[model samples]
Target: MRLLAAVDLGEGLESVVESARFLQEGLSIPAELLHVVPTPYFEALGRRFPHLRPGLEEALSQVEKEVQKTLADTGLRARVLRGFPAQVVAGEALKSRLVLLGQRGTGTLEALARGGLARYLLHRGEVPVLLLPRALKAVRRIAVGLDDSPASLSAFRVAEAWGRALGAEVFGLHLVSGQGGCCFPTYLDPETLGLADVLARAKAHLESLLKATGVVEVSKGDEELDLLRLAKAREADLLVLGSKAKSTWRHRLGRMVEVLSSQSSMPLLVVPEATVW
Candidate 1:
């Protein structure tokens, strides 16, 4: 089980490296650092004007050297490749247990326009992807969304494993919809007898699914907001969620995954559909 840390020539490079270190130590897995020099623009320009090929090659070489220097003495295996960044990473992910990426925290339009790696991998990649914000340095607490699906179960297992490894508190959150609308009665509201029954069922289900104690919590309301609120209440530093698979792109990413991907303030770890333990 190897972890692949994808780095780029961005201001978040150091933070990504730090995140890699955290995972390397906590997960007890060997990590390979990769820097992919995008080739689309250079390849197109070089094809149009053959004279620029040598210059582009030299520039690429320089970038590789810079990446090597940055990774020096970091104790991580380093390699550089030239291709479309997302494609290259996805290819590498086939052999990796997890892929660590540094998100620029860009908005929806900007991310789609720039072809965000996180979003792309979340939908299509084979392995789970761990996205770290530039500001996150460590993982002390983790929050995972739970459901009966294999992907959601995989998410909880990952949360449990990482939490045990890092000695971080793990929180399991399950959100239920209200009677007719998106929102639901609070789990603690004694006035709502319906909520009491729902909360009992939710806890019992999670207990059976997780086989763990005191880590489960149930919420009723907006899926995104309730999950986020539970995470915030737990003071979690990492949020874990699972994505579902579908024939169409629109259905591949669940509404909760879509919302948290853009709105999460902490680092996000997305477990893909049909992920194996």
Candidate 2:
């Protein structure tokens, strides 16, 4: 398996390296560090003043050197690809099993642009994308969103790999319907099913799903807020969510993951049902 990292030579460089180490420490996988070079905007000056070209070359060389130094101690290979950074990341993500990118992205334009490069890459890339925040290390605590769906089960499987790799503990949270006294007539409604029965069913499903792993710690709550609260309260480094690339429904993936992708304070790791790892 290939673990591709979108390495930035700036403040978040450590987070990029941290991700590479996280994947490599457990699985002896092939890892690649990608740096995208944006085309110069001042192209007209290059023709008018030929001397300007050499300075651009020098800047690129300096950037390459900086990236090399940042990854000197870490066993990561750096590859500089030339193109628009967002497009490059999206395109190369196809060849990778997992893409590790720093939050908020890089470059003045992308930084200044609305939503930033990270947001664009998340929407564009089909592969599982991990958005690493600054100053985070190994996945010590992981919280997974749970449901009876196969996609959620697949997410739990990926979480097992992460948990074993990091030597961490795993917890799960399932949202019960009709929380906050607003009762909808859906099948998931706790008011309709009775809280006790709903919880019992949830526990039974979790026991059956995680029987082999011996990870029986899970809770069924009333809302997604409960999962978010657990994530923050436990100081979790990663929040794993299940997303299906193509659903039978009219829309692609629903609004939940999309909202979390934009608003989450903690790092979000998405595992699509079709993803192998």
**In order, what is each prediction's RMSD in angstroms?**
3.4, 4.4
The lDDT for every candidate, in the order shown, is 0.78, 0.67
lDDT tens string, model 2, 1-277? Answer: 5888887666677777777776766566777888876755545567778889889778777876776665665767778766678888788888888888776544446445524566665554377777675544666888877666667677778887778767877876665554553212133455567676766666566657766434433454454556677688777778888776566453344444655665566778877766656
Cα-based RMSD of candidate 1: 3.4
Model 1 alpha-carbon drift over 4 Å, by segment: 73-75, 106-110, 113-115, 181-193, 246-249
Q: After superposition, how far is residue 247 of candidate 1 from its true place, in Å?
A: 6.8
Best by lDDT: 1
